[model samples]
Target: MKYLFNLPDFPDSSFVMQITFWTGKQILFKNDALVEQSGEKGKPFLIPDGNGKVVKAYPKPSLPDFAPILIINGEKHRIVAKLPWYQLVLALLPLLLLYGGALGGGAGAIAAMLNMQVFRNEDSAAVKYFKVIGITVAAFAVYFLLVTAIYSVIA
Candidate 1:
């Protein structure tokens, strides 16, 4: 989603991370370029106070405790880039391809199993994203069954 915000810690008094339609959807990083949920997420949200500090000249809001201040312009904003179902489909796509390949040839199944390594919520961002999707638990079920079935058949 396009965002016009700023990080909390900055050298200059005024620094903003402005995003527009041309820039496309971008994620604002708090402390670094890559924002991993596990890492310490400094204040990185925006709230338009429209008061003294906020009204005067874009007071470069400090990142709020919560991240990703969505819908700032008073106009309802739809999530442009978030797709929880799509992630599940994407993660499962490769496996589906592997399943097809393995079904065709046992080697493909083995290769798929080897490649599709399911970890236990190692990536905090992934966990959070999945949790937001409301399909993490269900996704795990399908993932377990699919992987185990493939392995059971091949091994």
Candidate 2:
């Protein structure tokens, strides 16, 4: 997802933001360009400016009512836009539907929706589709077995 904000205080300073995922993947985006990235999963690292100063990037801070904050050039800029929770729910809806006994085309459709939301930009089209199919099938099998076991016990 992309975030846009107006930094009125520091209008001339170029900004870079680094997002460190839970898997320790760091994606660095400076303005519109990706400056650096790491695919290896481990501890998160700091994003350093060209002059060797570390830019502070926080995913979530304790400061109430503040979004993700980026400290660049000693100024804090709040990221105004964020991925909506409903979008996240939409992405995970397929797995939830599978648990609720929806299968077949319904599951596939939901999985497609999820793939569009979650993997569209990150992975190639073929890989995204393959992951969607795998996830949908796995979800269906697990949920079907769970339902069958429950039915067997009740019957």
lDDT of 2 by residue, 18-87 (tens): 4333232335455555654323342222454557765444343423212355554456556654445543
Alpha-carbon error at 116 in model 1, in Å?
26
Assess every candidate by TM-score: 0.19, 0.36
Clashing pairs in 2: none
Clashing pairs in 1: 43-63, 44-63, 45-64
lDDT of each: 0.35, 0.49
- Looking at model 2, residue 81 earns an lDDT score of 43
Per-residue lDDT of candidate 1, residues 5-41 (tens digit): 3423332333223343333233444333433222224
Q: What TM-score would candidate 1 get against the native?
A: 0.19
Could you tell me the TM-score of candidate 2? 0.36
